[model samples]
Target: MPTEGVTGANKGIGYEIVKALCQRYNGHVYLTARNAIKGNAAACKLRKLGLYPIFHQLDIGDEESIKKFRDYITKHEGGIDLLFNNAGVSFNECTQAYAKEAENVINVNYFGTLHAVEILGPILRYGARIINTSSFFGHLSNIPSSSLRNRLAARSLTVDGLCHLMNEYLSDVRNGVHVTKGWGDSPYTVSKVGVAALTIVLQRMFDNDPEKRQISVNSVHPGYTQTDLTGNMGTYTAEEGARSALFAGLDAEGLRGQFVWDNLAIIDWYAATPPKSF
Candidate 1:
C-alpha cells in the first residue's frame, strides 16, 4: 500500500482530505498540523470512527519543522507515495501595513511551500503524486501585466528564477511601487501564483530526474470555500472544497503539471477570463 501524507490537516479542507483518504485509501495516512495537540486530537477523532491516521507536527512556515518531518518520514517509511501540500496562511481586511502583511503571507504561502517541496523532493518515490493547493487567484490572468504573466508561464523559467521573481514582488510591494511595477498588492494571490508556477517546475524536474522520475505534480483550486482563511465568506463547505484535490491527487490519470478547479475540472490557468463552466 502506498503511504499518503497531508500538511495542515487539523481542520478545514486539509482535515476533510485526510478523512476521505482514511476511508478510501488502502494505506496509512499521515495527518500533520503545526499544533501537536490539535494534530493529535484530529487523528484521534478519525481513530474513534475506526479509521486509522497518524499524526505529525509540521509547520511549513518553519524550516526546522519541515526538515524534521522529512527526516522522520525518510527514516521510517523510506519515502512517501502521495503528498498534499495543503498548508497555507492568508490575511484578512486591511488591518496591517501592506508590506508587513505581504511579507507574512508570502513567507508562509510561497517560500514555505517551496521549502517544503525542496526538502521533501529527495524522499518522494517514483510514481508518487503531489497535489499543490493553489487558488483560482493563482491563474496568470489574475496578474494585471501581460508581460509579467508571460514571464511566469515561460517554459524556460527555472526554480531559482521563479524565486527571484517572487522576491521581486515582495520588494515592489514593500517600496509602495508594486502597482507601478505591475505586481499586484494581494500577497495571497501572488503567493498562490508562485505555487501554480512551482507545480510546473516540479513536474519538469521529476520528468528529468534519472533516479526519482515518474512522479506527478499538479495544482488544485479548492474554490472559495468557507474556512477561517476566507473569514467564512464562501458558500462551499470544507468537504466540497476537498473534492477536486482528492480527485486530482488520488484518482485522476495523466494529470501532470495541470491546474484543477473545485468542480473536478481542469482549469486553464492562462485564460484571460474564467471559463463559463466555472
Candidate 2:
C-alpha cells in the first residue's frame, strides 16, 4: 500500500514519485490532493500509462478530511505499508512574509503531517515506512549568522531541545520578536527545521518501541525539484528529486530513522550533539 498527498500528479516531483512507486512496487498507490479535478486528471494520465493508481482527495490541513480518507483506506486497502508526507506550502515573497502566511505554512507542513501520523499510526502495520519531505534550507549551515548558526549547528542538542527551540522561534515570530531578537528571519527556514526535528523525534520513538521491526521514518530534501512550490526556479526535474524518496519508501531492508539525500542516509550531526555547535 502506498499513500501520497498534495500530489498534482500531472506535473512535478509529487507526480514523479507516484510514477516511480508504480514502476518499482507495481502495487496499489494512492494519489491524494485537495483539488479533485487536478487529482483525477493526473490519475487518468497515469492510468493511460497502464498504471492504475488510485485517486483520493486529501487536504492535510483539514482533520475531518484526513479522518474521512483514513476510513476509506481502512475499509478498502485493509492497511497501509507506506505513508509519504509529501504535501506542504510556502509563500513566494520571503522578505515580506506575514504572520498568517507563516502560520499557514507551518500548519500544513508541520502540524498537518503530525495529525496524519497520529490518526494513521494505528493502521500502519509492522515494519511500516514513513517518509517526510524536508529541505536543505533547514540545515544549520545555511544560516549565515555566526552566533545563531553556531547554536543551531551545536552537537549535544537533542530532538526535544530542537523542538523547544522551534516552538520558541515560532512564538517569537507570532509575537513580532524575531527580528528584534535576531532570530532566524525566514519562516520557511524555521518550519523546515521543525520538520527535521520532528523526524528525529518520531524515529527515536519508533526505535524505542520494541514491538515493531524498524518503522523506518525519515525526512528527505528533494533537491531543487522543479515544482510549483519552487516557482520553476529549480534545476533538477521532479522525478530526479524524488529519487531519494523512492529509495526510502521502498528500500526498507535494514534502515530506520535516517535523514536522506539523493537516496543515501544522512546523520543530523547537530541533533546528535546539540550543545557543541561548530
List per-prediction Cα lDDT, in the order shown: 0.89, 0.71
Reference-based TM-score of each model: 0.96, 0.84
**Can you tell me which runs of candidate 1 are displaced by over 4 Å?**
276-278
lDDT of model 1, residue 226: 88
Tell me how far candidate 1 lies from the true structure as C-alpha RMSD in angstroms.
1.3
Top TM-score hit: 1
| lDDT by residue for model 1 (1-278), tens | 57888998999999999999999999879999999999999999989999899999999999999999999998888888899999999965566677888888888888988898889988888788899999988888888888999999899988999999999998898788988888776888899999999999888877888876688999999988989899877869999999989999888999999998878889788788765324
Give candidate 2 misplaced runs (Cα > 4 Å).
Answer: 1-10, 94-97, 142-167, 180-182, 263-278
> Which lDDT tens digits does candidate 2 get at residues 1-278?
44433333445777787887777774578888878888889889998998877889888889998898889988887767888888888755654657777778777877777778778777787778888887876555444455655555444455557656666666878899877656656777767766766776777777777865457788877777678888876767887888777777876456566667653556563542222111
- Candidate 1 residue-wise lDDT at 137: 86
